[model samples]
Target: MAKDNDPRLLRGAAVRQRILDEAAQYIASQSSIGKLVSISIGEVAEVAVYVRNQARVAHQLKLPFDQEFWGSDVTQEECKARLQEMNDDPSILGVILQRPVPDHINLRSLQSAIHPLKDVEGMNPASIGNIIYNDVALAPCTAAAAVELIRETGLNMEGLEVVMVGHSEIVGKPVAMMLMAEGATVTVCHHMTRSVAMHSRRADVVVVAVGKAHLLGPDMIKPGAVVIDIGINQTPDGILGDVDTEAVKEVAGWITPVPGGVGPVTVAILMRNATIAHQRQIASGWLT
Candidate 1:
């Protein structure tokens, strides 16, 4: 419900583009020596969409990108072996495992098989563990995008009161850790929380990533608070976010829209992460 000219939207777009341009420039300067590879165990519509978008961005940046698809019957061992092979390959600067792998495969095991330096998606445990010591360069893309959007508000992160309404490893937990590292007092809530509104009402910033449509409403928000909706739920009407955008925008000082809000920025952050992974390889003398 934010106005079209909202500074957060404008700045997010500008930052995303700038990062993409910078990443593209870096890859070109490197003579496109490394490739960004995404491996999927099966054909998933959502995964395909994500990979296609990534390929498009890589194309614009002139980065080498490839997708590897395996049969649905691929075993966990096979997936891990492939990931290990990619991890050991110095020519592969970044590796990503697409989600929704077969039920039999151990996704975490495969994730762990990826070299921490090449985990561009930041799903590897090592990459996330580094965040505890404030090593944010390898943080997850969506979490990084949320933090970037909050920074766009020009608010002081130090001593900011933030309520993160999700505890998932992918988005909620990492975001809370990142916010806390920035000196924000963060309270993480999940399905077990008795009163979500109680915590959210006192927060200066509310980030919801629970994937439930219209879960956060106007009454749950503080006046002039920065609301970041990280949820993307496909409803009968269309795609909606966790917050009731129209109502929250009226009460909140700033709010991110469902479609145009976090998605684009998240994609850009992935490109930035890929570039960072490549840089780390260079610094470690893996790429000369």
Candidate 2:
């Protein structure tokens, strides 16, 4: 297996650090600004990991980051009320509602409650809707990361044949829309697709986000095609991605590894989104 050290991966890390450094300097220059608050319901191990990583990045950036953990019994309305309060708070520049919230909570309702300006996670309908007009500056982190990795290939986006596996609103659908906005020819495959390999093998690029582990083997990919795997599945062997990395690496021109690939870039994009949200708040006269 030929493991490629994608220059884009290193470039993303460099960009992430640069943004944090710039943000730290900006915060130092400003009197009162640059605070990110994340709200979570219940004790989810995955959410804890995400929150910890975000907190670490925030500290490195010299931006104040806080997390609010609510009991599983917290009602949807209660969460919405809290979000509304944060929305009105001028001290808060960005707000993130962690996923896998309690089943009692209506995620969509609470997401909508978050003011679009403070919705740093970009899960709000308004943020996703903005992509329809090609306003992708505030797109979902994971989806944006996938597209960025594809761009790293240095291939012309216009008429690029891309087959995206999975059709979830957060990742699949938005990635497809964003790719289309870039003038790519996108074919999205989901559970009902007759033959995913048939479509995938014909594409110039393939992005897989289905949670199933090692679903895309080398045979499914076109030789020299760029592969971006967005899946993170825990296996007996450890963390795994949707694509079979060892096998696909030998055939694909470039590919993203599970833990080291999209994950870091996604976090970087989140920081970028936070910075952008802060800029939007400034534009709206919410912050001076």
Candidate 3:
């Protein structure tokens, strides 16, 4: 375990607080803002914890929040229809669709159904595409959170070498794109990569989101490299991140611990996105 006062360990409390503070200021300036609606397809113990955290942060920001639970048997068409109604409802600020939805439901299609402006999660195809144009104000929560932490390091983004492990749309892919938008030279590694370590070893910063506990170790990184472990895997011992925190921290210049690192900031990013969605809604004249 990393020592409590270890300077190398990057905890999310400060970053999360900074982001929420900015969000709170923005939200306070708004005259009328709608509630953030989180929709869950079915009861999942794990997802409930995430929803609770998000709700807690929403309350802290003083943003109206609502939760909806739909039956698991609902059809994909019905899900899309309900989302469309939310898009038209001025009282609804943004919509968050929880993951691991029923096997029969089309997740991507449902994401596309959410309007880009209200797609606070940035999972919508249109929202992801907007990153290519250098518009990252509204981006995937985890991806955006990762970028925010990297910035917290105070390193110059332009031309910084970054290696991203994993290629999932919600995290890896968007992160690479978001970094590039920040002027960082990014290389993304996946299962087919000849050797992930070879790339990570040379990177100034390495962001891992492969969802495998302890996949990265001391040997895989260069001395003093910034390590951002985005994975959250369950184990008998407890929750663990992709990087071996205890061992990697010895060699790493900085590393984010699993549960206290990216997870909290992710919830804060969601609230920030809500504020951005509110701004765009007014810009589009959808809300007065």
Candidate 4:
């Protein structure tokens, strides 16, 4: 493992702090910002942890925060109705719908129910689609986090060679689109791709978001390449990222560690998104 102070490791702590500081300043300048409401459908431990992190950050940023834990049996209609209510409530600045809702809930429908101006998490289909037109101010949290880290590398984005090793809607797809919006050429590789490594080895930057642990290794990339590992897999050894960090570190110029890499930046993006949502709300006449 590289030393904690290793320059090769692209730890998210600094990037997270930069964003949080900006968010705090922005929130303080606002006349009357509304609370960010987090909605969790079931009693999942992971969801609990995520909510806690978000709430803690909200408190630090001095942004009002609220959360609701619905019973596992909450119906799809009930979820939509509550989101509709949040949409109408001016006190609610934004809404974050936690994932892995009860099987009975239509997650997509609930996402759509959140008004676009209040969709701080940017999970709504309309929100994600905005990336295609290059309006990334409200991109999904994780996808935006990946793009933020790449920017931290201080590399010029225009025409940068980027290979994205996943195609999932939430993370992979949006990240690719976001990168392309910045003028980087992005090739998305999925299970159907015959040679993911073949595409990655030649790229200036490689982003891996497939859920598989250690799916990317040193041999798959060229020396001095930037590797953004967006996967978080729980293994008997511990939580691991899609890229084999230690091994890949030897070859890649910069690599993001699993737990500390993209995770913190993701949470920070939520707060930043709230501020963006606030600005858009004022512009759209949703708030004064």
- Measured by lDDT, the strongest candidate is 4
Instruction: Please write out the lDDT profile of model 4 over residues 1-288, one tens digit for every residue.
Output: 668999999999999999999999999998878999999998999999999999999999999999999999888988888889999999999999998898888889899899888999888899988989899878899999999999999999999999999999999999999999999999999999999989999999999999999999999998999999999999998999999999999999999998899999999999999999999999998888
Candidate 1's C-alpha lDDT?
0.88
lDDT of 2: 0.85
Instruction: Estimate TM-scores for all models.
Output: 0.96, 0.93, 0.98, 0.99
Which stretches of model 1 miss by more than 4 angstroms? 1-3, 6-12
Q: Encode model 2's per-residue lDDT on 1-288: one tens digit a residue.
A: 323454323234544565566656766776667689988899999999999999998887777898899999888777877888899988888898899987778889998888889888888999999998899878999999888878877899999999999999999999999999999999999999999999999999999999999999999999989999999999998999899988888788888887777778788778878888888898989888
TM-score computed on alpha carbons, candidate 2: 0.93
Task: Work out how many backbone clashes candidate 1 has.
Answer: 0
lDDT of 4: 0.93
Superior candidate under TM-score, 2 versus 3: 3
Order of models, best TM-score first: 4, 3, 1, 2
**Clashing pairs in model 1, backbone N/Cα/C closer than 3 A:** none
Taking the tens digit of each residue's C-alpha lDDT, what string does model 3 give over 85-167? 99999999999999889899999999999999999999999999999888987899999999988888898999999999999
